[model samples]
Every structure is written in C-alpha cells, then in structure tokens.
Target: MSVIIKAAPLELMIIGGAALGAYIIANPMKVIKAGFKMSIKAMTAKGPQKQDYVELLQMMFQLFQAFRKEGPQGIEKHIEEPDKSDIFKAYPSFMHNHHAVHFLCDTMKITLSAEMSPYDVDDLLDADIKAIHHEEHMAVHAVQTVADGFPGLGIVAAVLGIVKTMAHLTDGVEKIGALVASALVGTMLGVFGAYGLIGPTATKMGADIDAEGRYLGCIKAAMVALQRGAPPIVCVEYARRSIMPEERPSFEEVDKATKEIKKAA
Candidate 1:
C-alpha cells in the first residue's frame, strides 16, 4: 500500500517527463514552453460565458446597425480607432483577444472593399476560423498523445517490478507478499494515470477548443449577416442565435441588450 501511494504520483511525473522530454528534445524549448503554457491556460480558462457572447452580439449589432444606417463611412469612425469606438471600447475583453479582433476587422474590411455577398464572406471566414482551430488542435493532439502513452508505460513499470520480485521468489512468504505488492503498484499507477488525470485533462482541452470554436462561429454569423445588409438588431440576433443553446441567451435577454445598444448609440 505504501508502494502504491508513493509510486502512483511518480508514475505521472516519470512517464510524462519522459514523453515530454523526448518531444522537447525534438522541438525547440521555446515552442515546447509555449505549448505547455497554452495547455495550462486551457486547463484554467473556463471559456467565454453566455453573458460575454451576448454582450459581443449586442456590440456587433450596434456596429452593424450603424453601418446600415450610415454606410461604411459610419463604421470607419469606429474601425479606424476601435480603442475609442464607443461600442468596442465597452467590450475591452473582446477587443483584447487578437484572434477575435482580427476576425472582426478582416471581415469588415472585406465587406467594405466592394460588393461582396455576406454569405460568401461568412463561409470564407468560417474556414479561416476552422484553420486556426485545427492548428491549435495539433497542440492538443500532442499533449493527448503523451497522456495516452503514460498508462501503457506505467504497465511497463509494473511489469519490471514483477520481474524484480521474481528474482526473489526464494525469499519466502513475507518477502514474497511485499514483493508482489510492490509489483502490483505499477499496474495501479498505470490505470490511475489513464483514467484519473491525463485522460480527463485531454478531454477538457478538447472541450475548451470546441467552445472557442463556437464563439468564433458567432462572430462569423453576425459579421456576415451585417455584410448582407441586415439590420443591426437582426444581425446581432443572427450571431446570438448561432451560439450553442447552452451558451445562447434568452430572446428577452438579447432584446434588452439590443435595446440598450440602440439607446446608447
């Protein structure tokens, strides 16, 4: 039992370090550290909220509405200087996320460039969002791969322990019991690593990535609808409704936000 308690935690550090050290030796330490940091962030960041997205859609609606009523010239005031844009300035968190910022700005720029169908722009932007997510997925995949291998290597550790115990097969009953117990520890460690820690963490990161995908999709829908010349209220509605139902706001919630946006503008 003592063997079980002591070796179990070490199984992760030992197996994980081995896998990571192998990978790190092949990749640059800087890149590995960045991947490590993102993995940690993935673990911590609870992800965007229903409220965050609702506000985002509200702000997007305000922006799109102004464009429809005032034309591209209307948004130029805000886009040229988003820091001062009364709408964007209000949602500083959304503004600070570079990916979200670039996604919003690039789509608007494409729309402003000429007579482009918003639907086509929406499809292209969706593709872009997918590409960004796919790249992030690679990092996720690597960490998961390491996690997957840990349990198997832990079994290998257990097997080695059993082999060591066999060499003492003649040590009599008490020693044999201790040896057998120690050998079984490796197996316990393997199973624990598989189910308790690494697997859950990998699954969590995947969920995080999936949630982020939805948020970006919301951005795409709102901007595309705006490009198609929808009302700001209607465009925001498009964005808000695109959210997965769990993350979606009530119609009344969106309505209130849209109303306030209008009152403010």
Candidate 2:
C-alpha cells in the first residue's frame, strides 16, 4: 500500500506547545533545567564499557603486584599519596572520575586501616554503591514518567482538534475530513512521543544503570578476593569475570597480562 504523507507541524505545535506550557507553569525554570541536564547526560554519557573492565583489571593486577613486592607499606604510600602514585596516573579516566577514584581508594584504605574483613567490607561497600545508584534513579523515573504521559497527552491534543472542528460545523464535508484528520495527528504524536522517544529513552537509561552497576560489582569482586587473601591473579580474575559478557575479556587475555606482571616482578 502507498503511504499517505501528511504535513501537520502546526497541529503538533498546538498540542505539544500546550503540553510544554503546562510543564513550564508547573515547574520552575531551574528544576526544568536540571531535568534537561540529566536527560542530556543520560543520552550522552554511556556506562563504563568492556575496555573499562580490562583497564580496571590491569590496574588491580599492577597494584596487587606492588603490594606483593613491597608489602602493605608500599601500597600504603600510594593510598596516602594517590597524587604521586604512578599507578593512579596510568588510568586517566578512573583517576579523573572522583566517584570511581574515591570508591577504589577508600575501600583499599579501609582494608589497610580498619583491618576490616574483606567479605564484610565488600558487603558494606556494595550497599553504599547501591545507595548511590538509587539516588541517581530519580532521573530514570522522571524520563519514564514523561513517556507514560505522552500518549494520553496526545489524546488531549486530539480533543483540542475536535473542539476546533466543532467550531466549523457549517463547513463542507471536505473541511470536516481535514479537521478530523488533523485532530488524529495529535493522538498520533502522543503515541509517537511515548513509544518512539520517551519509552526508548527509559530503556536506554536502564541499560546505562545496569552497566554502571556492573562496574561497581567489579570493584566488589576484586576487593573481596583481596580480603580473602587470594593471589593477585585470582583476585583480578574475580573482578574480570564480574564483567558482563559483552564487555568481558577472554581468560587467556587476563592470564597473559597477569603473567606479564609476574614477569615484571
């Protein structure tokens, strides 16, 4: 069947404009701006990828090897002086991210200082990461809510079209058909906004959240293994395998890297 191409930008403007006006009236510009910023971040900044996992393992292996060579005292110097640590300098992305930096360093520092049980420390720190991500979830909820309302809002747009059509009842059948068709476009816009834009955005945000969650889980796996006194090779493996398959490196890759560290030692 041939497609009927319809141009109804003005009609969409009427409906979408009214919806946006209402949102503006309900929310302050600052709150709206913040929401906008969050939306942009969600769209632009994806979660850590597979290479990030590989880098993390590489870093952990190096650090663990350092600890093995010079004992806790050597690792302590890095923790105490992260700015001076060549290890921290190696991964600019991890180093630049204050959250990631603090998460990694704080756990190891506590292990050194609190004399904490590695498993207990891992559990407590995992809880902390969950709480942090939970707070970020408000952004996800905001997007999903926008999606849910879009279809109904489109119906609202359609009603305005009908109201316009009713005003011109004396018009010919041709005019009425045009009016009805124009009105349905609002409904169409709503469904389109809901499914095509907002719904997909929500799904993407969820995936991003899951990816970040896996990153934190890697930290947990490594820290737990270290606490349990596993060798550096085994400890990094726990972290490496914690990664999702789409991003996980081969075992041989990790093993070869671990061997390189041993060789360097």
Q: Write the per-residue lDDT of candidate 2 for residues 138-201, one digit (tens) a residue.
A: 6566567677877888888788889999988999898898888878887887898889976787
Candidate 1 residue-wise lDDT, 44-114, digit = tens: 78888988887788778777777778988889878777778887988867886667887887778777886
Residue 70 miss distance in model 1 (angstroms):
4.6
Show where candidate 1 strays beyond 4 Å: 8-13, 25-35, 80-86, 166-172
Tell me the spans in candidate 2 whose CA falls farther than 4 Å from its real position. Answer: 1-38, 41-46, 71-73, 76-85, 96-98, 261-265
Give candidate 2's error at residue 196 in angstroms.
1.2
Model 1 pairs in collision: none
Give candidate 1's TM-score: 0.85
**CA lDDT for candidate 1:** 0.76
Query: What is candidate 2's TM-score against the reference?
Result: 0.81
Number of clashing pairs, model 1? 0
